[model samples]
Target chain A: MPAGEICIIVPCYNEQENIKNVIDDIIDNTPSKEKWTVLVVNDCSIDSTGFEANSTGKADVLDLPCNLGIGGAVQAGLKYAARYNYDYAVKFDGDGQHLAKNIETFIQELKSDKADVVVGSRFCTKHNGFKSTFMRQVGIKYFQWLIKLLTGKTFTDSTSGFRAYNKKALKFMSKHYPAFDYPEPEEIILLNKNKFRIMEIPCEMRKRQGGVSCLSSNRAVYYMIKVSFAILMAAARKPEE
Target chain B: MSAIQIISITGSLFFILAIIQAIRLKRLKEAYALLWLITGFIFLVISCWQGAIDIIADLFGIVYAPAILFLFMLVSAIIVLFQYSIILSKQNDQIKNLTQELALLKNKAQGCSKDLPNKES
Candidate 1:
């Protein structure tokens, strides 16, 4: 079998301070022989994120007309991956949190033919990295328990944005993934409902280098309720063939 | 006629006229307008025949006659609102698809334009 084409989708919103380093890290760490291309999806940032990404000359930049939130931005990248017929797609956050070195593990897991989707879990191993704030950790644990209750599978990091998908997984998600607000936890339930094999590997993550997180402490309660309802809705929804 | 009857008839007439006027101005699509037009016609019938609510409520074994009308209005509002939510969801999906497609096509165009300089060189 031939080596497959891979598209690393970096969804950014006002990450002008960190987009360049993120893109460069991805480019530098990518295997030399692998056919890899970085695609920076600028989610209608008010800053010069789009311009910064364009000047990098190493990745393609897609400027959305309006702010589509993280879910919509990632979905846009998946749609592009589907349109271009990429064999694999990886979602790497542009906030300087996710490390590029871990992408190799995702690719290896995909090549191993064990899982259709690979999620990078920070809590899977005892690593001394910048785990999110205490409040966020509590919220993450809540989702972790919720997913376990719903899917009968344990996920240490239910809200980790670092993930990779094969063509089969990406195609289904491109069309059916929730386009509303945050989709990380809901998407895990969606994939499980559709019988997609999901595997998690340990990966290190850093704190955000710039820009405010969309989920502030004040919005945490709302985020939990919205995402929990969405997860339940996804569980009850019939799988689209 | 009772004062309530006169008020009901006037209200129903205005409602029906507003529906027609909306259709004329192309603000309401005929398909959706049909539901509201039917509702207005029912209201006019009930208003004109003072005993209509009494008879219908009796048939349904409802003790209070006016409560039946309120129930009818509530059910109608719910159905109309539910239909609107469905339409809103479909349009939202379309808008999202269009936005993504536009961005992807523009990226492709930029890629082609970037290659032109290399080709010339």
Candidate 2:
């Protein structure tokens, strides 16, 4: 692999405590021994996330002027990768739920040309069962059903943020990515409509190392309603060629 | 002086106020704000002259006026989203082209430096 073949994008918002550890893990665990770059997109964090990410020296940091939510942060990362001609780009959470060890599987799947976008699914393999509140499980199931209905494809984890994209997928997503909370489901539909291939790879998820889970019960309910309506609206619109 | 007339007049006034505010604030470029403006104006006109709106609705054979309003709102939302997507696509293309050009220039510069002889010698 030549220099800059693969780029890992980590979107951080006030995850100052875990950002350094996450980047260190990625630097240590990246496979292929190939030249890969990490891009830490700081979404206007009030904490030291931006400063810490820059201090680590393991990744390049792009600090957004204003907080644009997770969707906007991830989209900014994809746009950066796409603009720079990166062969592949992966989105890793800054809160540390995503394991760096599993990233190799995603890259290998992309290299095999199996899919343009490979999602890391906790449900795909029995290695580790997803540990979350029962309410979250219910919400996930509902979103999965909605994704299948809207996109005509069954996705085990529609809301997983650990995903990899080839150049083509990155290009498409950089343009039409959603701009709200829990945007993965709507993004899947948008990708499907654009005729990009998508696949799921099994991976384990851990609880956040520090800080609280951003999704409260109230927020989860609101997310469910908002995302459902957004997906319905997106489906009604014409698909982009 | 009927209820419909009062509603129409009020809607019209609100519509004008929104337009003037949008123009003053320079928010006309935002599609969401533009949609609101258009919706407001449509309501204003329709309310001010219910007879004309009824005639138009009858021509379309739409019995309930509120149903038509709901349909218009849905359509407006879809259009705004579609327009946003188009703008995003164009921006993506421009950025890609610019990056490619920069990469090419960097390669040329590297080649030129490599061909030069060592001045230290």
Candidate 3:
């Protein structure tokens, strides 16, 4: 792939109702580039997500045989992009939380060589729409503090899945991404350890267009414990020079 | 032997036995087993000759004997974490490379389909 080629990766579990609309929005928003492509990694979706994604001419459907969690699914997409030699890769949420309009900003940042990874942060700037619940806000803040302590960088929205990565970042993440849920914090630490530059771009997120969030009240506690342990373990380890 | 010596010897023997069992069951890898074995031997030696450890601890500028043990535990944890990170990063690289190769092969196969005959029945 050339220097400016970008691939958008969307990981879907059971977004049958929203998959088609998401794909259409992505297609409508993507600029005319010879090498730009959309890769929808279907994480063994029991719904018609795979069928709907295949129907969309804009995306390349990569269906996993078994359900890997969101982390695994995103890793799969990164692997595809890296293997294809794309210059940049962006991860977009399958549930429509990420807006297609913000993709241009990500591309512009990458093109200008501002940072290796550009993250779309909801809390970085004031927006009138879609405030996360108070509990969720607290959870995000705790993770953000942990990330800052571990990585020495303050990230406003550590859990936001909307982000773009340059080729080197893509290669690094593809090689060493977390396998379970809530990989964002761990990935940020890993990237920082490797001396990768990460920048936050302000973007608005919409409510989900389809199925409910995978993170329930019970799962939130589990996520906190697991992520905290993972971060501590990661912090203890020495990074390769 | 005095009562204190007898109790220390018995405790050291029990610790050594547990370490051996762990090694046998493969719960402890060889590198880790070496550390455990060394620590167990040190305990066994101290239990047999407490005066020797006292002299060494004094020479090392250590007042409390347990401080050495705590230091060893902290160092071992750090080493284990370092080794684990190496393994995890290597595994991640392999997974990424494999997935990328699979995607490329799929893309190549799709491209080749156009060159083949339409039907071969």
Candidate 4:
């Protein structure tokens, strides 16, 4: 078992249909003896996501006053972890796409101390999983190439939401996290530029259980352009000592 | 002065006075009001002198003197608007931080209250 307190930060925006099941899956899969807390950040969901998570009686729920989008919600979770002094924090999507079994794998990777952050990549292995739409896959590929060009680092799943971070990484990330506009690829550039060790592990993912994706087909061009500019800016940013 | 100069001078004076009054009433911060005050003063000078715009346009090799004034106003507007955008972006970040902090603090408070043993029990 991995030692030290771990926080599973689940940022949910109107995931009422799958939030409970996602939280339950995490609780059921992870070890019972180890110190781990599941934090559900409800980003002012119109649905009863907050109430459902609270009723579970097994997760800590933070009800944001207004919608801060995914970036703000995830940052809030990391801020909570940093304030409470947690050893590790893992970002798990609340739409039930991420697997709970991989949470242990992330903790184990962090324990080995080789990497400061671990990204769960679906394309890292040959395992059969929900590979996303063709258009999105093309977008992800473009981002992967762009990141490589800017940071000289190759990430198979550049936009993977399933990620884990240690104390140092989590504290640093909470402060600089960007808004909901394709922040994952930009984050890779940020982490790489800052000299943080980022590792990617193969993990299987399912299709999102409920709710529509924030990124729509119409906005794909805008998303790509915006995210590319953001990645370039992140690359040019000065690293904190 | 021509009739048009009289009208222009009156407008500039009114603009300057309005900015001053807003500053006096604390409706506008002095730092931000300074630009408007300076622009109004420039307008008053150009209107009163009449030849000042012609001189400026000639210096810039502009064929049309009135076009120079329009260009000047456009540039000033852009600069002022750009500065406001910067301030707005900063305020936006601050608001985001505050919201996150409020949520976290509320959660902590609830946890603390829940931990307290029931007095009635």
- Global lDDT for candidate 3? 0.79
Question: Which DockQ values do the candidates obtain, in the order shown?
Answer: 0.35, 0.08, 0.06, 0.38
DockQ (0 to 1) for model 3: 0.06
Instruction: Please report the candidate that would top TM-score against the real structure.
Output: 4
Summing lDDT over every window of 10 consecutive residues in candidate 2 chain A, give the lowest-scoring window. A1-10
Using lDDT as the measure, what is the rank order of every candidate, best first? 1, 4, 3, 2
Q: Indicate the TM-score of model 3.
A: 0.70
> Per-residue alpha-carbon lDDT of model 4 for A1-241, expressed as tens digits?
1123888999998999999999989988987666787889999999899999988877888899988888889999999888878889999999999999999989899989989999999888787567588888888888888888887788999899999999999999988887555689888888888889999999999998888778778988888888888888888889866
Query: lDDT for every model?
Result: 0.88, 0.78, 0.79, 0.86
| Model 3 C-alpha lDDT per residue in residues A158-192, reported as the tens digit of each score | 88999999998999888777766778877777778
How does each model score on TM-score? 0.92, 0.71, 0.70, 0.94
* Candidate 2 residue spans exceeding 4 A from truth: A1-3, B1-121
Cα lDDT tens digits, model 3, B4-100, are 8899899889988998998899998777567667767777887798787668778899999767667755886687677789878877656654554
Q: What's the best-to-worst order under TM-score?
A: 4, 1, 2, 3
TM-score: the better of candidates 2 and 3 = 2
- Which parts of model 1 are misplaced by more than 4 Å? A1-4, B57-64, B115-121
Worst 10 residues of 4 chain A by lDDT: A1-10
The candidate that wins on lDDT is: 1
Query: Chain B, TM-score, each prediction?
Result: 0.88, 0.61, 0.57, 0.89
TM-score of every candidate's chain A:
0.97, 0.95, 0.95, 0.96
**Runs in model 4 with CA error above 4 Å?**
A1-4, B113-121
Query: Which pairs clash (backbone N, Cα, C closer than 3 Å) in model 3?
Result: A175-B92
